[model samples]
Target: MIQDMGLELIRIMGPFDANLLGRLLLTLVLSGLVGLERSGHERASGFRPHILVGIGACLVTMAGAYGFAELSSERDALRVASYVVSGIGFMGAGAILRHGTTVRGLTTAATLWGCAGIGITVAVGLGWLAIAGTLLFLFTLTVLEWFERRLNFGGPISRLRIHLRDDSRSVGKALDALVRLGVPVKRATVLPGAGTSALLDVELARTLSAEQAPLLARQLLTLKKYVVQVETAITPLDEPTTMDESDEVQKDDTIVPLNLKDATLLRDLNDPDEAVPGSQTERSR
Candidate 1:
């Protein structure tokens, strides 16, 4: 049975050597194009992974179509292709990520799946479909983003850097504060900081005009336990991190709101039991 199966496979696959090689090369090109756009945007899994997925899927599809084609009339030759579709999900899931309740990389994950589809399409001799699918993927990644921005759908995206205690609770509170302010968090990360502190880096969308950043900063400082020191300054969205120390503190432009000493002083001056309430405190009832 084994010898006959080998013979059947050899006989069936013998004529498609040159065509198979051509399909692989075509699959490589189509998938590579999709990956190129993703890499240009600095996505998680870029060029090489995409090409690998596309080529791998193509090979699996080929095996499903030809490797089992001559085994028996009862064999389902396309079974492996179906598995490819379902299995691609694991790879796609790796591309998806969660950043402070804002899920990112959904598009990247979808692209990986699309690349697999491109591979399978080419493997099955559906070259036109593969090419068309690739073009559509590229167009969605490139053009759809521009339309999203132009529509004011996300307003303006701004980056905020908060250096605070390394405790996870503090980080959560800071993010919660941003959310309460009504700007949706587009992305967030906790980076290592000096000593016991961590940097809470966040990207916010639909932020108010740049002029209001100080008021916003002063406001965040109210989270005394969560935020150690706070200052708010607004520069063009493209220039979020470019401010120098001198510029960040200049009272004319930035608002270096209540530092720890000031918070303490207010508590000292006001009735000690009052808890210094207009740079306000949220008391649990």
Candidate 2:
């Protein structure tokens, strides 16, 4: 009869523990914010995945805290929390991406890891600490977004690959012309092409604004020694091959005046055997 009474008392109080209910509510709230940010940003691990991770992290944290609290002997909650850290790492790794020279999704993965830490903190009854962490994460993602744009510091950098005919003379002339123009050339690689074709890999400076590039490109077209091709920083092997493409591609807009002497000299260089015309009017349009 005494044993039955003890068991009934345990059952009655078991479902109403203040610490247990608090942990459940705290973890749910914290994880929800983390998941919300990911979903809003359109990540693959957004919505359901993040929510699950947050809840799971919270449970793990609760387990570590409660297990330690229940022990009569010495127990380290931190030891159990360390396992959560390692487990979160595996999830973070799945979010990173690599494409040629650019690596993306690092911030998103870091955010996921951060959510786990916050969840653990909440489970350990560090309510204030968890709230502060959530605010910091949102500030970094939202406020810093505008700050970066104002400085024009973030986003993908432009990469241009300039291709020319394989002839050494043609390439040399174009290089000389570019050098004369003071265009910041980052790198130039010679790539073998089919037949007598070849590619000149070019990296340019951001100082060359999109608006200003068209004017300089008009002069490049007037040069007779070589044709050009343009591409972004990463050029896929299967990309279509083309001639006379430049990083500064121009739409057929207003025409520029061509100096007759420059035009005659260019014509002579391209076709030395033929008689050159005096008027530059042929290329002016």
Candidate 3:
């Protein structure tokens, strides 16, 4: 039985020749085009990686076709093709990223899958199909990106955290500043601060381009009379580092409001607990 199986395997991979090299080259060029486009967009995995995926997939497909076409054995070419899909899936996973709540790298993963299909088509001598497939993939990525932006399918969103002065006039001026910009704020939250610094959350009214928001932030911060800090917050939608996660200072974070006298005392003693509410009187050791 083992001898017969060996014979079947040998018969399946018949006649490897020079013509196969031409097919492989075609696959490489086509795959490279796809990879090049991705690279232009500044993705993590770009041209070379995409080309390799396409080439590898093509080789696998060639193996499958030859095994079934020549050997007339029990092996299923379709089954082999399915394996290529699963294999490329793993490669695609490498491109994906999951942070706090947002997922990126979807486009990169999709391109990998496309390159695999092109490879398989080329391996089978279906050059036109492979070329067409690649063109379609490129159009979807490039053209669709622009179309989506024009339609505002996924508009820009920004999170702004502002520290305003404690006076009512300052708060009014801050609101007026936002009103002038015509920014449609989605949500706003108030952060309680000490005597002078009051925290405020100001969500954008509408999505602004990445550049527009920062320039606007610098303008807002310029109002020195009542404005202390105007920071553009990085939302949890993007993966945040450990240090990025800070307890939104509720009323509990401070022992008491920081004052000039408290600053002087803390500066004098290494440990200033003697002056704290619950501490005992300091004694000479």
Identify the leading candidate in terms of TM-score: 1
**Regions more than 4 Å wrong, model 1:** 1-16, 73-78, 165-170, 180-182, 191-198, 210-212, 223-285
Candidate 2, residues 13-110, lDDT tens digits: the string is 55456876776677677767777887787788766676577667777766665554555465566877899889989989999876333355787888
The model with the greatest lDDT is 1
- Whole-model lDDT values for every prediction: 0.72, 0.62, 0.68
Better of 1 and 3 by lDDT: 1
Model 3 residue pairs with clashes: 12-71, 156-207, 184-205, 185-205
The superposed Cα distance between candidate 1 and the true structure at residue 87, in angstroms, equals: 1.3
| Worst lDDT 10-window in candidate 2 | 255-264
* Candidates ranked by lDDT: 1, 3, 2
- Encode model 3's per-residue lDDT on 115-222: one tens digit a residue: 988888888788999888988988988998778545544454556777777666666566556655555665555678767678777665445444444445555555
The window of 10 residues in a row where model 3 has the poorest summed lDDT is 240-249
**What's the residue-level lDDT of 276 in candidate 2?**
45
**Residue 128 in model 1: lDDT:** 91
